[model samples]
Target: MTDASALRTAILTSVPADPFQTTAPEPRFVYVPRTHVRALDPDNMLVVGARGTGKSFWWQALLSDAARATLQIPSMSRGKLQVGAGWSENTEPDKDTLAGLRRAGADPRQIWRAVLLAQFDSGVDSMDSWKDRVDWVANHPEAVAKLIRSYDDAADADDTRHLLLFDALDRTADEWTERRALLKGLLQLVLDLRSTKAIRAKVFVRPDMIQDPEVLAFVDSSKVVGSRIELTWPRHELYGLLWQYMGNAFQGAATFRRRHSGWKKDETGLFRMPDTLRTNEQVQRDVFAEIAGKAMGTNERRGLPFTWIPTHLADASSIVTPRSFLAALRTAADETNHDSELALDWRSIHSGVRRASEIRVIELGEDFPWTKPAMAALEGLNVPCSRKDLVSRWTANSVMERLDGLPTGDRNKNATLGQQGLLNDLVEVGVLEVRSDGRYNIPDVYRVGFGLKRRGGVRPVT
Candidate 1:
């Protein structure tokens, strides 16, 4: 029976203590339902979710296990698509070489040819020349019609489960247009695979990236084919995931013990353990109550349940990772360890969660200018407005249009763009929603943020 403190130190030293374990780490956690790694079958699913919702954790977990089975970088261009400018003799002759050539006024077609050659060489050893590779696909259209097709055939024939996980596509520094193009192109490629039935693509995208017409186009095809899965976690499920991960990191050292063992066994697992003589369930309920109290004063926020304590705790470490929960806990542990205490702090955890949310909001805002205005307009209207109605009334365009017909103070594009961009920022921040029929609506979660009034006012309440 090792003490909790001694166990914590041993576990800390035993584990690498990295929350964002982009590389690898030992797995000790149970497969909580929320974070359960799904079997990679022939299904194209686009998984979209907010920050700290177990997107990356499950992604990495699948990737690590399915390494031999998954075709990670299926791009024919291999690594060339990621590289940008620069050339130094002392520097690496990376994929950026092609980007450098393009920058030096090289023909785009020629650069593409070289990249195609590189890809063929690395991906298809059977191919000899770039022309031959291109001709092979052209001559045998069905044989090599699309990148995903070839991979699919190979995967299906072997009964292999290939999980194509695309994470951080939004984080790419490519220009807005380029980013949109790349995603649309990749999605189009994925769309090509449905005809073959070989691999499954799961993309973890923030809501903003999915809102673009071009980006949305890709998913449309998949959705029409009925091959998309939205990533959402109930509060309880989310809490369960966090608890499972943390419990694993702590292993069975008395500090973190399980209530139940095997299905046929009588051992209690972590959920059955007692904290300060209180059962695990009781302790969890108490902790959640405390956290919810801090998040929303005892008044009880709208969407969040009054007894809301999801088994998992949301934090940045979970969001930025392939990292294990223990690793994230360790990172937080390191911060708290500075105070010579081996305990996790609620304040620090709460702050980490807030910081994670803020970063996501900022990123979404920058990428999607249309997001804010859409949200603000929805907020101001206090009710769903038709797409045309919103654009005609709530937007700066609407504002200008109203003022312009007055023969004084006409709408200005620059001012309108500035104002509209700000409003769009709100939408991107997940505070608003643009409905299918062109209407704009707010999520129930953010309804409180908008203080609505039915009274008539000359100026719209933004």
Candidate 2:
């Protein structure tokens, strides 16, 4: 038999190296639709999404002329856009400043305005005493406006637009209640900023940020919720992403060559890429079929590669992430490569599925430390169970006993949510799903993460 392992290796390596850290669209950057572009508007002020769906990628792209151009957002040509004058959870100074202000009881709106002053007012203070400097700028909007106007005049343009982007709201405060207050105040500030035409703010947040009762207390957030963009990946889009990655993978296949040749000769693909980047149906089917063959394995019973992978990767809320999807492909290749196979075998794909589940669990543990600890209590217990069965596992494992100071991935820190309350909290975060039948079933994505197995689902937890 001819050696085809190298071909398989090349095919695997052709996809993106790291889907999460994808810096450019070369190997793969999914196109953000015009509707999504409108939703991403800095003027829209609030963006809601889960862990994936390009929240971080979109936020980072806006900072780069190269990245912005690739997205083909209509707003880019609208004006001279100046990025991110406001605040982000990524910056140390911004995080510390907000934390300090919250520690000192400063209003979130005031703190946000102060952050904006750093960009608008050149002479604005950039020191640790950010509160006093921000307060000073707050008392003097004319100077900032003058600074803004002068730039508009110098550019010979009608106006200079400033965008304030906020992301990673979870990092704002480790203490649950304090974090909620900080987010609430920041939301109010965003709503208030709508009055200012030239200056705008965009917030990228996890879907559950607004779930706290106190955060919504007395605040009319209808406008904010309406603007929410749930970062959901559709079935076709997921397949489209697979094809897009393969098409860019620099593979020697005629199919990949044909698609990549277009991108190589056309400089426009890198910037202001066409709307039909990867939506070609024939190309998607041909490329995917070339890699995995017709079915996931020998028989149709094993499930098709395009459908089976995404269906298994999705969480309880039916949300699938690019991260998990890519992870499975890479893992499948890693597990079964160098075997005497033309492509990933059915057994290997399922193995990849398990590996992806495990990696996702570790990721969750990092983000929500309480994720494993709380869920581990149900290691041997199967799910889709009654409320009593769920509580029995928690009590048996002494879950509440170990929750003190554990991070729940949201407010209400200190494991203050008793057993039942913890279950409800998990449901809200997509960790646990409450069914219409009132029975609680854990999603497969998280089942392995928590080491919880279903009756007929994943293999027995080792």
Candidate 3:
């Protein structure tokens, strides 16, 4: 198994510190689901899952014409999709700028339409101000539509399609109150984009924003919601992602490929993997069995390795993100030892789980800064604890008393102050897991992140 050591070397060399920032190359992009491929057909929009759900990765990947071509979604093959940004890091003006237009007596919906128009007609940029752009759009609604249509007609004439992408709107405003108007206006604009067949827009919305009742209050929410796809990883898919990476890593290493030769005995003596892996049952069984053997624990009471890793790493929603999965794999590989039963020894895998939990904690802290302080209060408190003890822990750390000081940052714009309500909030975000007995436990994904240890779990290094 010297080649396995080489495989381990390749994995360690490839593991990125921030998995979200890393993009799997075209040949390596096997995690995408066919639903995502269909949703990518310009007209269908998907509200990506909470952070780390491949929202940003897709945004960057689809930006490359080469990547779009690999999509193999027949609709996109005409030519490279002409991508425009309704909201992106490089193009969008800040919240203050949008607020400036709002202050100028500009209707937010109209301003959003103006932004859409600007994407089609670069001439809108020559105008002195956003107000000027707004006025121009106000004066020529048909012209705006006609301009967008013209671009589509040109693309069609050239045998291609045009698509507009919207992502990272959460960056537009810090507070939900400030962000709501911006999103509501943009959502209306997206809903309206449906009328046009040539130019389609893909809006990557956050789940909480779109799911919020107030945000859905007045609009024909169904139209926008209907086009939405949520980013989620099933138990098997998470494992598939692991083998997909290893398979790709194999392609890069000629020596490793020469050594293992091929796992498929009947096929040519060379490794072969698809550009993307969906639910290929054979591939999952062979690749993972090679890495972690068949069973997870001594007598199969602990389940299979393919099942155990993803199951333990899942958040409250039972979703295992690629980020967490990879983190766990990298850690397991790093910690494997002589006494280990499998290539990825079951015992050694816990350290990976532990590290993934820590990274997840930090990421959650970044996503919800206020919740960080609140989560820290219960750091050492073991789970399966009663709500009374939970509240008592918060009270002990003065987190309950400082509820007023905790930043009420929320996706739905509703932050809780009451103890039980706050605990429920933690559960909603996958920070805490609730049990049938009304007791709560923190999943290992978040247990270490929040600095909490289970009653009989691993101790923190301090």
Best by lDDT: 3
Candidate ranking under TM-score, highest first, comes to: 3, 2, 1
Please rank every candidate by lDDT, starting with the best: 3, 2, 1
Put down candidate 1 lDDT per residue, 1-462, tens digits, no spaces: 333344344345544444434443234443334222332222535666564445555555554543212222243112111111111112222334423433445432232223332333234336664444434444454444455455546656775544445566554323455445545654564554345654445566665566666665644564522445545544444344444444445443234433223212112232322223222445555443332233322344522321221212222112232222333344434444434232444433333333333333343335443333433444445445554555554555454344344322112213346445434544545454566775555432233233332232111212
Off by over 4 Å in 1: 1-19, 30-42, 66-143, 146-157, 161-163, 171-173, 216-226, 250-253, 258-283, 286-416, 431-462
TM-score per candidate, chains pooled: 0.53, 0.83, 0.86
Q: If both were scored by TM-score, which would come out higher, candidate 1 or candidate 3?
A: 3
Tell me the whole-model lDDT of each prediction, alpha carbons only: 0.40, 0.65, 0.68
283-375 per-residue lDDT for model 3 (tens digits):
666666766777765667767777777877788878777788888888887888734545577766778878777777777876666576677
Tell me, by TM-score, which candidate is best. Answer: 3
Q: Model 2, 44: alpha-carbon shift in Å? A: 2.4
Backbone clash count, each prediction separately: 27, 1, 1
Q: How high is the lDDT of residue 190 in model 1?
A: 51
